[model samples]
Target: MENPPNPDPREALASAHRTFATEIEALRALDARLDDSFGRAVEMILGCRGRVVVTGIGKSGHIAKKIAATLASTGTPAFFMHGAEAIHGDLGMLTAQDIVLGISYSGAANELLTVLSVAKRMGTRLIAITGHPNSDLARNADLHLDAHVAHEACPLNLAPTASTTAALVLGDAIAVACLESRGFSREDFARSHPGGALGRKLLTRVRDIMRTGAALPVVRADTPIADALAEMSAKGMGMTIVVDDARRPVGIFTDGDLRRLIARHGDIRPLTVAAGMTHGPKSVAPGALAIEAAALMDSGRLSQMLVVDDGGLLLGALHMHDLLAAKVI
Candidate 1:
């Protein structure tokens, strides 16, 4: 096989410009066509007690999958069903309480029509997203969203380019509208996506990942400098919490403080932690968001912090590395 020759820069630029212009005009047309039907589509999905079933064939199917994902992540339960598979037992997934979102540019795809028919027979509501307003699927549907495009981005206007983009944007519009109506929140999204980094930012709390109880490195204010150093070494967090007789954190001695102390006094075994520790360091409650902790550490240019209670009682210790381990950084 041989590689193709390079394209003429002038021709390439012209082609790119035409494609973008066509798609932009198609989008403008779609916006102008938006009407009460859009509101009805949103209401249909909002009123659905069961999951939103998204079905389509070809390029629309790809868009349908994305729509289903957006709907599911943003609090509306949704799933994608391939149009071809609907009659081959996938239709069993539909229920009377569910709502069907059918995507087809022509609004007359046989595969999608069959799926919509089964949905109607099962007492499910049908919402059609199509370029043709009067196609079979649109006429049969309970609600119709016209995704009509002036022309495809392809020069011949035969490909599913502009129409697909319009469909995708329309799907996003519907999803976002439903999200706002349902009061979809960050916590709700985090709960649905617990394994992602954004989920860690929202769902993970100081108590969930902070080193607590025996895992915390602690030393008394009266403890010898050498003993405090030992606590830091044993814990491997590069710092030790200095507590009063009541077990409340009075100060924190970090590796940086130790360096400064050694510069002042080479042999500090005789010194107590109170003489070297930084007093009243910044701290967080157990319920604080992990991202807030990260921000506190970042703003103060710190690596470690004491987790304290309302009474300043030492509850746990957290380090920058802990945030890294929790994927909060």
Candidate 2:
């Protein structure tokens, strides 16, 4: 195949600018026209006891899929069902307890109309998002969200650009409203996205990443500095906890302390661990978030922090490398 001639860069840039302007105008119009129906839609979804089944066709179908994902991740139980597939056997996924949110730019797609019809017969409530308020889907719906745009962003005014953007933003508005109404929190979101970075930050506790048992470098306050150094090297944590008889952490000594001790006084072969250990070592509870521990370590310029119980009994130790290994930093 032969290569086509490149379009003029200025003309291409102008076309891009026009598209952005049209979409911005459409969103502004949508924001101004939004009214009580939006609140009503949120109320209906919140009152629902089951899932929200979002359905659409063609370009509207793409928007519907994203909206469903957004809703599901933000605390509203939802999933997308393609309009054509709903008629083919996917309709079994729908029930009277489910709410159907249908999207069609013209509100006249045969496949979407068919799905809405079956949804009505099943006694399922319907919410319609479309550019046509008087269209069949809107009229039959329990609530109608107007997604009408002045015109398409396409120069020919035939493509679905501005209208689809309007529909998508409207759906986001509804989902966010429901999310706030339900008191959805960051932890709730993290629970739904355990494999994502936010999940690691919010769901992972210090106990999950702290080194314990044989991994912890621990020593008695009166232990020889050579023994403390041996324990730190064996644990590979670059630090050792100086604990009392009750297993409560009272002080901490690090490689930095060792270097400072050497600089202050050469040949300290008789020094005890207590001679260089920092008193009142910082600590966090086992239940605290790894991210919180990371913050404390960062602000205090600490490489190690102790985990303890209410009675101050040391349970574990957190190294800076542990937070890095857990991807909490």
Best by TM-score: 2
Give lDDT: candidate 2, residue 226.
Answer: 91
Q: Write the per-residue lDDT of candidate 2 for residues 1-329, one digit (tens) a residue.
A: 98998999999999999999999999999999999999999999999989999999989999999999999999999999999999899999999999999999898888878888898899999999989999998898889999999999988999899999999998898899999999999999999998889999999999898888998999998999999999989999899999999898889999998998888878878999988888999999999999999999999999889999999999998989999988887
- For each of the candidates, the C-alpha root-mean-square deviation to the true structure, in angstroms, is 1.9, 1.5
Cα-based lDDT for every prediction: 0.91, 0.93
> What is the TM-score of candidate 2?
0.95
lDDT of 1 by residue, 1-329 (tens): 99999999999999999999999998898888899999989998998999999999999999999999999999899999999898799999999999999999999899999988888788999999999989999999999999998889987889899999999999999999999999998899899999998898999999988998787889988899888888899999999988888888888999989998989999887999988889988899999998999999999999997788898888898899999999998
Model 1 lDDT at residue 18: 92
- Candidate 1 global lDDT: 0.91
Residue-pair clashes per prediction, in order, are: 0, 0
Q: Give per-model TM-scores.
A: 0.93, 0.95
